[model samples]
Target chain A: MSLIDSISRPRAVRLPRIDGLIQWIVPLAIIAIWQLASVTGFVPTRVLPAPSDVVLSGWKLLLSGELVRNIWVSFWRASIGFLIGGSIGFAFGLANGLSQLSAKLTDTTLQMVRNVPHLALIPLVILWFGIDESAKLFLVALGVFFPIYLNTLHGIRTVDPQLIEMGRIYGMTDGELFRRVIFPGALPSIFVGIRFALGIMWLTLIVAETIAASSGLGYMAMQAREFMLIDVVVLSILIYALLGKLADSASRVLERLTLSWHPAFQKR
Target chain B: MQTALRTALPETELASQANFAPHARVVREERLAQTSGLPLTIRGLRKSFGDNEVLRGIDLHIPAGQFVAIVGKSGCGKSTLLRLIAGLDKIDAGSISFGQDVKPEDIRVMFQEPRLLPWARVLANVEVGLGRDRASQDADARAERALTEVGLADKRHQWPSVLSGGQKQRVALARALVSRPRVLALDEPLGALDALTRISMQRLLERVWRDQGFTAILVTHDVAEAVALADRVLVIEEGRIAHDVVVHAGRPRARGSVELAGLESSILSHLLSADDRT
Candidate 1:
């Protein structure tokens, strides 16, 4: 056996599949580099603490329940705002799309409104709603509204009119047409709106929280930055990234489940 | 616009077919007969987009149970004519009245594409042609029967995507037929099918037309298909009926027979001549 081992080399170590490896590799690589930098003083310990220190801080915050409290406050703000904004956007988009006069009157104004960034209205929002949660929620809601509206309008308008005629000739009532034909036809675009709206929700939330909040991951990061608690600041940013990823993945799962009939999502 | 083919066919045969089987004289005539005097009259149908006139002062009366096949080359207003009849588009200077009391629900159109809801099952799509009160268990049974007519009874739960192109078209036909509509309009229903599939579907359509006896108006680019299937093929050119040729070959038409081939060739030449003229 010893002679054979010497004569014939052992097989090379096998690597895991790309998808399987990515799960652990990315987080490990990040932690390892972070640890290495901290140890080497490439990035100063004071300015950018070690990965272990950030993890410790994160655990402490979690255990104290401060993180959960702040996270819930932030989530509720986003959720309520998203619902309000998303519904209005969907309704208006569909109405404008179906009616010629409504579309002609509203499209130009909507286009103009969309060009003006939601953040540009921060001062005005603060004046109207004050520095309370309502102002922050309103900002996030406003941020989410336009993309959902525009995408919904585009989706509704682009449905084949032949299909609509088919619906009509088949004795489908207006309600039946909307439910069976129009809604399903526009679903893929509606999902696009949801995705875009989700993104905007996060952006507005972060900006609003940073500017005025007493709590929230965004507020925590801002406070940590002022105190030069580099590890805590890093932890807050990481929390934000995780939350955003979780929300996006959840939306994608919902989309896939609902739009199973869509060409892209259909199983082989 | 009388053509050589029209002149070649015996005038007596034309007159005899026109008078003898007046109900079966055209594709939609048999269907119109089922309605027992359907007053589907149109006068001076005109449509235009900017300065381009797609339809120009066209007048045609689709009597009850008239199975009319409107044939035209691309941009010859064949589809426009069908759309006008189906009431999918409004005529600029024409009036279409389907009797004095005909409801919109009584008219059913089967388009070239199935236009089925991909998310909906075959049965549900078939039932889509019926209203809520009309969509009962009996209606569902009727839908199944319609599916059976199309030879797709077993595919009731299948999604539209899972079906073949021909199967999808069959489902569309079932949906159109399920309504028991007085007027059934077909806009090149089999235009997208492969050659073998198209032949089978033609047979299926003939079978269904015989059984259901609904008025069907088909708009097709295939002159041979028109001659083989339709009772009277109406050639539309420049928004008017240029020629109307009756196929005296009778039902259960033999596939690739000399008589059928001769008629097909004659119709093909007419279309080619029209193309050359343009």
Candidate 2:
């Protein structure tokens, strides 16, 4: 008999999935009330436009292709910045975590640099790159770097020593030990870093875009604010919320895929 | 603590700790059955962590396929000796030579913790034991054979996290066995297991030892467990083997039998009396 068949799968109780819309009730009600109030002029339109007005602004931007372009720009900035910063941080973490000499050489300097608020350097960053793409990239990368680096380093350091000893005793080579034991052991913590960095990634992009930029969602919002297009401004805020949620969900999906064996992830 | 364990309960009480059939098919391979164990020659083995000497000149010889157990109080350096023997800790002032020029996989250690990789499925965790041969064509077959030997063939696809504590330790045993190790150093492997699980594991350990004929060196705190499994029991006091007791009993010795219990009682009393003296 195939052993795989005997694993006794936990069948989650199924419901027809109009069941999912139960969670949407409050949000829909709020949206309805806000739209009603906005249309009847219960609240001044200039201060906070109706949800429909914001949706109209989004439609206008979408038809003109401005929405897609800005979304693409923001996505590109966030991802590229994440990749560059994340890789560098990962490399440094590996080097430092695995070697006393490397740790001694650079960890103190990195820690000192980490203490200074990354956003506080926005003024100097603007002066350095002057509204160019590099300023935003720099800010985003810098914002993304510390969390990943710290988490990666902490992850590597806290990996169970007994497991390492067992690996060596079982005849694992240095590379094999790292691949089969060290990396997997540190992965949960590393994922923590990824989730944290993703948040920082968008936060940095939004701030950088809003402060100085020719393109991106932040620039779009900034332009709307200048022209007092409150509906567009509100739409940008909603879009930022959506973007943040989207990014977090993507990381969560990746986390679930890799860490399916983790106890916390073993449930339905 | 010693007094409580010294008092042997009824045989049925001891027998209730059985998680497996009394005679499970543990002997998977008979190709090279009897002479698989490597003889160990440890000469004046000394180990110290800085100024504190853990093992002070431990000179001992273990014959091929001998089941030896070392027992001692908390600070008596039993684990230090085992670590030195396993080559996990460096000897400060001596040599430990094996009967043959052994490769890394020839010797294996099973620690108290199962140490199964949580990221790996049960089968992959067992495959980790094949060492350099883990990538070979027959590695999966060998691991499957080992898992079968431990009666855990069916749980191979499950995650390590899902397995019960006893089952996890059994998987660790399968991993250690997958290497076809000539020497298996068990550092209180059953220490973390519950009483029922511990007894079941003890039997599994003995069956595998008899089947594969590996040099088994178990370091433990449980006197009854040591008496139950090991052919020879060595009690350490002040980093030295104070008593080298041999159990002159036949195979498949009954659990909680008077003979075994008497020996366990005497050893525990001696250990306790010594503790009081210190």
Candidate 3:
């Protein structure tokens, strides 16, 4: 959490305490104005509740314990889906990248499936998995797979041929060449895929939870919408935005840790 | 260069040796072939990329511990010949033999680009040249000594990206030298450096070759560099050895000395006329 803060307020760009406070002024003012408008009836509470009302509803949910439980459930689903899809995609990428036979066997079919939007398969997914947790997990996994697969393949393929040649001339076996040279060379591209997969992971989870999920942020939003509890719905959206930002920041930290030797990531 | 020889011999011998200094260096080189470097012989070597024959019917023999420089026009097959000698590429016909069994680590090539693994630090990059022995106990010490030889020991912990162009090339040299190769094939290794850096690097190359006694095969376009450092300069034209020039310049020949300048001009003219023909 502190690392994420440091990235947002980088030491090079961050100013003194007074200026640091100034960075938050615009958002605070917007919230204040929003509260004023709700009190003065400029906007109907039914359509869009005030930020304070959303906070109150969030507090109520926290006391009742649904907020923590639902958040955990959503986080768990995304983690499991991301892991399953990311690993399989990486395996396929290594297979195709290293072996011409594997590429010729599976590349055409993968490209064909990649053309069909994964979200479009939601109806068929529902029919196949019957609108349960499996349906949501499958959708999330399918949505995240293609980006990781394509990027990992490209990353491996695009590694500098000269470096590979150097490795060969230095007496590196095929396995050592991949481990010492090719994989590190491909990591920057792989990180790009991870970030893309994260986006798709969240998008899939959002849609998946709405399909009869008994627990999760998306299900909470759906239940609140039916009851016209606008504040709860707004709170759930805010929570998602926060979670997505956190996930992205976490990945960026991982990227920096792994690729610090890269020119772009090295400390100034 | 003179101080060591002068101290080793008496002042009377030094004065008498001035006239035959070049031959004295040659005699010393003959002694350097005690078994460190392997002598190479090639017979009717031929290589082609499709229909365009790169090296046609090449025949040559190089003694162990001899510093040879090959000069040519861009497509004159000097690099192709070097690649064949190093076994980086296959020959279409004929043979290149080291005259003995040579291990995988016995021959190494340093290309124009540093080709250091950017993901690896300077020391790790140098360690790569040790072949299968990179995991041995003495690998780190050997790599460090090679870096110290190239005068970049201070930069061993840094990434290759952070080094200057000349420094990166030095690191590459260290990597090539760490393996203690019997044959070192240099494919225009200093072609990208600035003039001053190139000259300094040349001096370093000469010093290391003298100390380690590797069979150095340098492929370069600079005739001045060829004459100053090499015992023999081979000019390639029409995919064959067009001129075999022997330089008798003594150790540490002064830049632009009369003897070296004459050899450089003659080789440059050969290269330019080859260009004119094309």
Best DockQ among the predictions, by candidate number = 3
Kindly report, for each predicted structure in the order presented, the TM-score of its chain A compared with the true chain A. Answer: 0.89, 0.91, 0.90
**Top model number, TM-score:** 3
Q: Looking at model 2, give its docking quality level.
A: medium
1 or 3, greater by DockQ: 3
For model 1, what is the alpha-carbon lDDT of residue B47? 89
Location of the lowest summed lDDT over 10 successive residues in candidate 2 chain A: A1-10
Worst ten in a row by lDDT for model 1 chain B: B19-28
TM-score, one value per model: 0.84, 0.89, 0.91
Output the lDDT of residue B20, model 2. Answer: 18
Ranking by DockQ: 3, 2, 1
Candidate 1 whole-model C-alpha lDDT, 0 to 1: 0.78
- Candidates 1 and 3 compared by TM-score, better number: 3
**fnat, candidate 2?**
0.88
Candidate 3 residues B40-131, lDDT tens each?
A: 87878899999999998777777788888999888889999999999999889999999888998999999999999999999999999999
Q: In model 3 chain A, which range of ten residues has the least summed lDDT?
A: A1-10
Q: Once all C-alphas are superposed, what RMSD does model 3 give against the true structure?
A: 6.8
